[model samples]
Target: MIATPYLLYLGHSNDEIGIKTSRGLAVFRPDICVGEFRHDDCGLTLGLPRLDFAAARDAGARTLVLGIANAGGRLGNDLVEDALAAMEAGLDIASGLHQRLKDEPRLVAAAARLGRTLHDVRDPRPDIPVGTGRRRAGKRLLTVGTDCSVGKMYTTLCLARALQARGVKADFRATGQTGILIAGDGVPLDAVVADFISGAIEQISPDRTDGGWDLIEGQGSLFHPSFAGVSTGLLHGAQPDALVLCHDPMRRTMRGLPHYQPPRLDDCLEANLRAARLTNPQVRAVGIALNTSAMDAAQATDLCARTADMFGLPCSDPYRMGVDAMVDLLLAMDAPAATETI
Candidate 1:
């Protein structure tokens, strides 16, 4: 099923992950959400009609999703207790953390005793082979970001929605937990072995005769010291024909890691293209998706215009712009005559 209701946990100290999941759930439409989560640090809608574990269990929420994406995968004291309590209530647990819930003895025992399942979203299949790019077929696009948490997943989701609204067939491929939860089914690229990362994408989006579009959600940035390798792997693995570069105007340094400065947008875009073309010779960047939530309307508009002019491609905030500027480019490259106007 495309839509499934579950209790999403947002109690982690990293409120940013909670906020991202909260926004994602707005599109996913969970049955009920709990905790204080918001995009901008300012105003947050406290699910004050809050539903605790007991309340959620009574309401028949059999599945509990740990939606927070913290830096260290260690289950902290706060989340540990909450997860146990939910498990005690006989609710199955789903987690997207690098630290697998199944590996935790308490949760594992609790699940066994209760006969419930622990869904570790990051668990990758063994023996996943290397990618050949020969599996690539149909229309495909990827959302590459300038830095971490710069709206690659959000941009990809919005692009999928926009494509569908235009009566085009498209699918949003998830490479992270929040995106996987929203997408219902997708492989977590980071969980797979380094050698098979691209292979995972190849498996997720093999050749398609239906002429459908695959919006591959990018993981890390090519400039990020810790995650640069992953970005290169995804680009080479997916072999997308089109690409969208995502950025946040407010971000100066890479998230959490300040010593490393974020690269200029043009440099990031150029590098991503250069790396991607190694896999698919026809690959090209179609547009830019800017995240300007911190900026006021006037500032956002001005920055977007400048970015568009600088890149000589359509620039938009997927939340506000809906990828309208680049959809025409994708459609033209995918199907010229049919999508000439739209």
Candidate 2:
């Protein structure tokens, strides 16, 4: 595992979504995060103490987490220099970019000379087997979305916590970099080879008989042309018995692709269910989770109510509003049908 007590490196990020890795860690694993490191011109903050490499190390940080998520996922020359400096200040380096830190000659040489570790969190293990498609023993719920960055991680996390609070055994299975950092373990499905993506997910979440739930975090949308393959692989591998559709109503178009419009909620849900049925024919949608960050309190509440009525399923903003209704519905699934199945 990458060392903790992290000093999150934000670099010079100005886009809020681009800094999702740092934001996720700060919100979900705050105790392990020591401080934030950014250029003077950077305006983002995680509400943590600001410190340089030396100060962060002195404050007991063991690693510097490169927490930026740019479009290309490339490790720029400036970032490489910062990583070298962090190692000099007695800290290891960890990254989840598409570019591997271990492959960078400069970073590799510095790490070896300094006796520091380079954690390429996005790197997949080599021994993953092809998906067997056999039924597993535990209950699972996957959070799907209408588009990317619509809070699938957040919804899964909330449901896991809520289930645990109700005296049920539950675990959050991370699938992406942000989720991986938050849960401390997961397969970076997006980084895995196309043929092994499903296999990687199967390895990440295997059979269990605790009568509990494995809340598997999701990746891209089935409608997103850029990431549909990853999403389909995750869907089949999860074999989820239930699903929670996540959406961001404020987006008029798919994230990063303004040319393509977001799919209608009905269309997105049906498409995901059909794809998921390839593994678990009984898989049903449990609820709807919305990222209502753009809405006021009243608007969020009203939208949730209308959505619940529209779909005949419990709907709520998993962050601003508690997912108690969804959790309750999930637990009561053994009873008669509370909602329609696909």
Candidate 3:
């Protein structure tokens, strides 16, 4: 486990979306978050107490979470120096960046010399088996997006919580770095070898006879050029019984790809459903989750209503509004189609 009571390092990131690793933990797992560590130029804040590495360690922080994210997940020279200093100050380090912390010679040497552990959250275990595509006993709901960072993890987490609140057994299966940290354990699908991505998910979320649900957090979009492979692998591996299409209504273009347009909701959902059918022919879409954080309450609600009407599926801003409607639809999958508009 990545020792908790974290000191979240924000570095100098000005983009809120880029610092989602820190924002996600702060919003969902605040009890374990001791404080925020930011450089002067950093433009964002999690509203946690600001603390230096030494102060954070003194405040019962055991690990420094390198929470910033970038296009390439690269570690800058200054960030590496900060990491070394954090280790020197009697704290272990945990990171989910594409750049492996264990691979950096300076960090590796510092870890050995200071007796500090470096937890590379992206590192997959060596023993994952190949996917059998055999039917599992329990139910699963996966969140697919029209683009990356379109609230897949948020929707999955909200659904899991709402299901549990209704006395339905549910587990949130994390697939990305932020989700892994929030769930405390998950297979980093992007980090797994392409051939074994599906198998890795299969290993993490095995069959359950308890009639519970596994709410698997999704990764990139099927429409995204850079990460569709990972998304397809995850969809096949999950063998999900239901799906929730998550989207950001405001995104005019695919994230990080200005020239590419976001997929139409109908097209995106159809593609995901077609891909999912490879493993579970019975897979169905239960709801739509929108990232309406950028809109007013009235606007968000209207958008959700229109979306639900369009798809004949329960739709809501899982964050601004509750996911109970979606949960209701998920639990009663035997009911007739709401509208068959799709």
Expressed as tens digits, the lDDT of each residue in 224-337 for candidate 1 is 998988898899888888999999888878987989888999899889999988877667889999998988888888888998998899998888757887888888884322
> What lDDT does candidate 2 reach at residue 219?
92
TM-score of 1: 0.84
> Where does candidate 1 stray beyond 4 Å?
1-3, 11-19, 27-49, 53-60, 69-71, 76-81, 84-90, 335-342
Worst 10 residues of 2 by lDDT: 333-342
TM-score of each: 0.84, 0.90, 0.89
- List the candidate 2 regions with Cα displacement exceeding 4 Å: 334-342
In candidate 3, which residue pairs get closer than 3 Å at backbone N, Cα or C atoms, i.e. clash?
none
lDDT of 3 by residue, 1-342 (tens): 678889998988899988888999998889999999998998899999999999999999999998888779887798799999999999999889888998899999999999999988898888988877766767889999999988999899899989999999999999888888877788888878878988988888887777788999999999999999999989998988899999999999998999999999999999999999988888999999999999999999999999999999999999889998888888886422322211
Candidate 2 per-residue lDDT over residues 86-136, each given as its tens digit: 999999998988889998999999999999999888887778889877777
Task: Choose the strongest candidate by TM-score.
Answer: 2
Q: Scored by CA lDDT, what does every candidate get?
A: 0.77, 0.89, 0.89
97: Cα error in model 3, Å: 2.5
TM-score for candidate 3: 0.89
Model 2 backbone overlap count: 0
